[model samples]
Target: MKHILALLFLTAASVMANTAHAENIGCVSTTWRVVNNDKVCVQSFKDPDIEGVACHVSYAQTGGISGALGFAEDPSRFSISCRQAGPIVAKKPIPKKQEEVFTQRMSFLFKGLNVSRLVDTENNSLVYLIVSEKVIEGSPFNSISTVPLMPWGTQAPQFQLK
Candidate 1:
C-alpha cells in the first residue's frame, strides 16, 4: 500500500511540473487592448530555445466566456516581431532554410501560430518567420524580420567537410 501511494504521489507531482513548465515556456498573457467593441489583448512570450530574442504576439478576442472555450472561438489572426533585445549568442548554430523552433495554438479548430528560425547565408543574417493559419484553412498573412549580424563579431559557424 505504501508503494502504491508513493507511485501515485510521484506521478501527480510530475504531471503538475510538466504543466507548469509548458505554461512558462509557451504563452503568457502580457497586455490587453480594446478594439472596436471587443477587447483585444497581446500576450508576449519568449522562445525557450533562443536566448536574447523576444517575440511580441498580438491577437484579437472574440466574445465568449473567459476560459479555453472563449479563446478557441477567437480568430487565429496574429502578428509577431522578433527583436534582439540583448546580445544574441548562438550556442548551437542555426541551419539554413525553414525550421520551426516554436509553435502554439492561437485558437481552436486547428488554428496556430508557428515561429521558425531561418538562416540567411547570403546576407549573413538571421531571419524569423511568423506564420498564422488554420489546419485545413490557409493563411493569407505572414510577417518576417531579419537581424543582421554585426560586422565586428557574430559570424555564422563554419563547417569544414572531411
Candidate 2:
C-alpha cells in the first residue's frame, strides 16, 4: 500500500538520520541476569552542525527480562566528554546559549537521554552536557565537559559563536 511504503520510508530515514549523528563505540557488561546482561554503553558522536569537534557519552543501560523486552528505562546517570578533534570550525552560527545536539531513546516510550552544547564565546570554548528526560518529569542528574577552541594547524578556520 502507498501508506505502508511511506511509513517504511520515513522510519528508515529517521534511523539513518540518528546513525549519522552518533555511533556505539563501546559497551561494557555490568550486572548479570538470567534473561540478559546489563551494560554501560558508550557512544561517540560529532556535533551535527560543527566541524572538528566530537563528543562521547557513557550511560548505564538496563538489562534482564524487562530490558530485553524493550520495556525498561535506563538510569538517569551518565557522563559526557567533548574535545576538539581537529581545527575547530563552526559551519553555521552557534548560539551562545544551550542547544540540543544529540539524543537517544532510553526506553521504548517517554524516556530519553539528551546531549546539549553550549558556546562560551568569551572563553572560546564549547560545553557539552548530558541529561535524562521523561514524559512527566526530568532528572536533575547531569554531566558536562568542555573543549577549548585552539589552532590545530596553520589553516585553522575561525569559529563563530553568536
lDDT of each: 0.56, 0.82
TM-score of each: 0.61, 0.85
Find the number of clashing residue pairs for candidate 1. 0
Q: What is the per-residue lDDT of model 2 for residues 25-60, given as tens digits with 9 covering 90 to 100? A: 988888888887899999999988788888888999
Candidate 1 regions with alpha-carbon error over 4 angstroms: 1-37, 66-68, 151-162
Where is the poorest 10-residue window by lDDT in model 2?
A: 11-20
lDDT of 1 by residue, 1-162 (tens): 799767855754453333212223233343432422344465555545445666665665554344334444555566666676666655455556666755655554256566677777778667777777564785777777776654324644332111
TM-score of 2: 0.85
In model 1, what lDDT does residue 79 have? Answer: 69
